[model samples]
Target: MEKLDVLVLLDVSGLEDKEKFEKHLKKEGFHTVPDEAFVYTAESSTTTFSTKAYILEVFKKGLQKNTFLDANLIFLLNETPYPAYYYDKNSNDFELSESKEAI
Candidate 1:
């Protein structure tokens, strides 16, 4: 699989373990973006380059587990022209983002 650049807009408003989540992101190859609030970038790879699959296969099972229990994640394909995807703690699946606050 080809590596994809992911732009992550992390909403950690009610997260209790911000440091732990940040550490998890770092371990996942994500790095903070300069001058941005909770923005990070990472080179990720998906089996078929599908954003939805990536969320379910990676985020839901890993990074978005207990570490981000109260956070919302908005992922953008940095080098592709695909629509963004949104994931929240309560949602088991991600969707095409319609939330203006996240975009």
Candidate 2:
């Protein structure tokens, strides 16, 4: 399998502890991008689970711990301009509502 590129968009505007949140993401191996986006690329051979799924799990746990509050996240696979799964804060879960054909 090919490496999958993941992008996580965090809403940090007006948050007092934004730096701490950013640090947490970086500690988890995400690189910062412009506009509150953090990125990570996963090599398929190195991990047993799907890259997107793993990232989502990380985000979910982070959210539960208030690491990313008032934030909505989306997972984009392989550098695509669209999201494969979006985090639903109300439900605290990732929803795969995007069409694969869009990729």
Candidate 3:
């Protein structure tokens, strides 16, 4: 499987434990995008799942335990930008956003 390039936008503005969250992100193997706040990138190998499915799994897995947070996940499988996801406080999980620029 080809490596998928993923862009992650984590909104930790509401969280108090920013250091812990950053540590968690580092442990998850995500690299911070240079000169960008809360922006990250990761290369993923998706052999068994589609790009969307893979990103959803990643987004869910990256959530902070016992805290509701929001994130935007964008992945490119074949050039065009796929739908992004946002953390829905009501659902307490990631949900698809209509636009990649959605906030």
Candidate 4:
């Protein structure tokens, strides 16, 4: 299976049932890491190394640099030449967009 990314809206305080979350996602056959700043998937129709790298970069920034917390809502993309959609929920309404630059 190829690496994929899923952006999760995590609580600033922390996540509840984190282990369970990972377990549930894994059980459903989607690669998961609940404690990660962002959740990613490998269950996409196709996989690419670039996409994998993009996911890692975003997660690293979110976890290490706290970029994910910068906005109530932010959009992220799966690492790939053609990015996937990550909805940001900070605004009055959910926001959506794609990544154009390299991760």
Task: Work out the TM-score per prediction.
Answer: 0.58, 0.56, 0.66, 0.32
lDDT of 2 by residue, 1-103 (tens): 5555665554333344555655666666666776544443433333334566667776666556554435445555555554455556678786765564322
Report the error of model 4 at residue 52, Å: 16
Per-residue C-alpha lDDT of model 1 across residues 1-103, encoded as one tens digit per residue:
6777777675645555656656766775678798897787777676435654554354444445554444456666755444555554466655556754554
Top candidate (TM-score)? 3
Candidate 4 ranges with C-alpha deviation above 4 Å: 1-13, 33-39, 46-78, 81-103
Q: How close is candidate 3 to the true structure, as a TM-score?
A: 0.66
Model 4 scores a TM of: 0.32
Clashes of 2: 0
lDDT of 4 by residue, 1-103 (tens): 6434544332333433445544554554446455565344544434455544544344333433322332222223353233333324343222234544322
- What is candidate 3's lDDT per residue for 1-63, written digit by digit as tens? 677776766654456555566566677667778898777677767652554565565556556
CA-only RMSD, every prediction = 3.8, 4.5, 3.1, 9.4
Candidate 3 regions with alpha-carbon error over 4 angstroms: 47-51, 66-79, 98-101
Find the candidate with the highest lDDT and give its number: 3
- Model 4 lDDT-worst window of ten: 66-75
- TM-score ranking, best first: 3, 1, 2, 4
Predicted structure 3: lDDT: 0.62
| Candidate 1 weakest lDDT stretch, 10 residues | 55-64
**lDDT by candidate, in order shown:** 0.59, 0.55, 0.62, 0.40
Which 10-residue span in candidate 3 carries the lowest summed lDDT?
64-73
A best-first ranking of the candidates according to their lDDT comes to 3, 1, 2, 4
